[model samples]
Target: MTRHTVNASILLTDRPLLERPAAARAAGFDAVEFWWPWPQTATPSADQVDAFVAAIEDAGVQLTGLNFFAGDMPAGERGIVNNPARQDEFRANVDLVVEIGERLGCKHFNALYGLHADGIDEEAEAEAARANLSYAAKAVDAIGGTVLLEPVSGAEAYPLKKAADALAVIDSVGAGNIRLLADFYHLAVNGDDVAAVIAEHAQDFGHIQIADAPGRGAPGTGDLPLDTWIKAAQDGGYDGPIGLEYIAGEGDPFAWVQA
Candidate 1:
């Protein structure tokens, strides 16, 4: 009875970005989520955004979550909205991200707190992140949407490596719409107590995403108790769709969902 959402950015890697919506539908997913589709932090043109939106609509799938501009994801760029120098890029993309959400009825927006640039100390970058995140919260709130903060694992430079870390930032943002994104894969990869965190913070969780630990592969492919923790979240009151954000390693991504 659990509902699942596929992350098009991670699933269907063989297809073009926009085309992944149909691929998700073919895989039996009715809702999908994605990171920023642009390869760089630069703002994508309106035409490109439109095409992406149209692709989702034509595929008849719902967009459940989206990330603000994260630079070069494959090359290890996290998110740039926290960088003072990159504020313009983040601000520009906010409108675009929100606009697409408006069209698709998507309410979740993720803000990646990018690592610091050379000579930019941690304290300074954290300040910039706080300011930019507040700005983003207000912008998304205008359209009746919620802003999500996630903790990414294996990327030491990214800073938000634990649920507590992300929750701290959410507190600083101080907006009613701001909430934590509890991504189980990242939490386990970083060695956090997954069930304990979910049990404690389920109500504050605006979104949930999962993949197995140690390999970032499918559920049965790793050692984590994906089901136990998922049930824990639901029992604790997290009714949001759990996104299947994992690497497809030679198997159908929907197999776990079907089971």
Candidate 2:
């Protein structure tokens, strides 16, 4: 069976933010991931960062993947790495994110390139994104970390609508530690051949996150050919933990199958 890292941001919504790590451990997850836990601010207070790290440590589950602060998540902010106006905010959060990584022993970082509001020059934003990604790469290199690029589906007209699209951005940055984050749910939603994608780029991926399509629900509750894709990923040389970034609804989400 393939072991999975639970995405605490989505799976443990029932509990308070600080308690979700323990909740995930109780749910039988030995590893977990998270979006930027702070939604309101790109740069959180030192106390906030320390408490978050403490919670994860207390829970005893390894943090496998974490997102860099983009903007207000619930309010539809995807990422600000490409936004020139928010470049300072992104910069301020970069080292803080790396600091947290040092504390957690986690080396996988997800960087979302949110859509800059309309009328902005696409070229400028893309350039800003390239520069920012490179900047992040330099900081994380201290810890031998990899920065991730994820393409969300129909998310606010975001430019990275596909895995290949994100790969292009990663390449443009020319950072050795940058890699693609193959999210099955987003790929499936956008009509990408999930298996073929895995077959072709599995080796280039630093992380894999999944959920069922149609509703972003737990696996087996939707029509995604998860087994085939997982097998393809394995056959294609991806030996990393696939993260479960789905909604559990009202039951034990980890009950999908034993890892």
Candidate 3:
């Protein structure tokens, strides 16, 4: 059977992360992903982590990936890449992600490209993103995992929004372990041809996240061509989990996209 996973971030906001395994399983998801696991907000403590791991195992649910290191604390606007001042913080974040992956046996990690500073040269930003990706790739490589560099929408300062721009940064990084993570809502937000773009970057795509275009809700809740894009993804040789990273609509988001 083909496997598709939903992120716990979408379905279990009312409960803590440690309690998400049961929720995901109850929702008929065989595997799940999450945004971040740090500082004990959404993440569990060490003992809780162990318990959560056991719960998932007992429930027969897998963790597909983790979106790591969203932004600098407090402000939470800018990303680790393209911000020279946050390189150390970025490295530390990468370490934490790797450690979590090791404990959880996850194979994929996603990095959010935060906003850039004003007056920053585009080329310089690309170079900085490439360098940061390279560092993350190495860290992921050491753990036998791959890193997906995601270009988010709704952020004007993000250097990479278009598929071509993200591909360029991935090429510059030149790390075999680093790949592109395409988010459907973000692609639509940035006005990219979603199906065509995914087809074009098929080989470089490591994972996919999906939601409705306008409100980032469940598939079919908005105007994104989810069926078309999903077909295109299959044609492009993407065999990993299709992540449901959207806001829950009136009911189960998975119901809208069931094949």
The alpha-carbon RMSD values of the candidates against the true structure, listed in the order shown, are: 1.2, 1.2, 2.9
User: All models: lDDT?
Assistant: 0.86, 0.89, 0.76
Query: How much is the lDDT of residue 107 in candidate 1?
Result: 90
Ranking by TM-score: 2, 1, 3
How big is the positional error of residue 168 in model 3, measured in Å on the Cα after superposition? 0.8
lDDT of 2 by residue, 119-186 (tens): 98999999899999999999898998999999898685788988889999998999999999999999
Model 1, residue 160: distance off in Å is 0.8
> Which order, best to worst by lDDT?
2, 1, 3
Flag regions of model 1 displaced more than 4 Å.
none
C-alpha TM-scores of all predictions: 0.96, 0.97, 0.87
Give one digit per residue, the lDDT tens place, for model 1 in 103-181. 8898999888886577887787888888878888888887799999989887777789999999998887688898999
**lDDT value for candidate 2?**
0.89
Q: In terms of lDDT, which candidate is strongest?
A: 2
Q: Which ten residues in a row are the worst by lDDT in model 1? A: 250-259
Question: Comparing 2 and 3 by lDDT, which wins?
Answer: 2
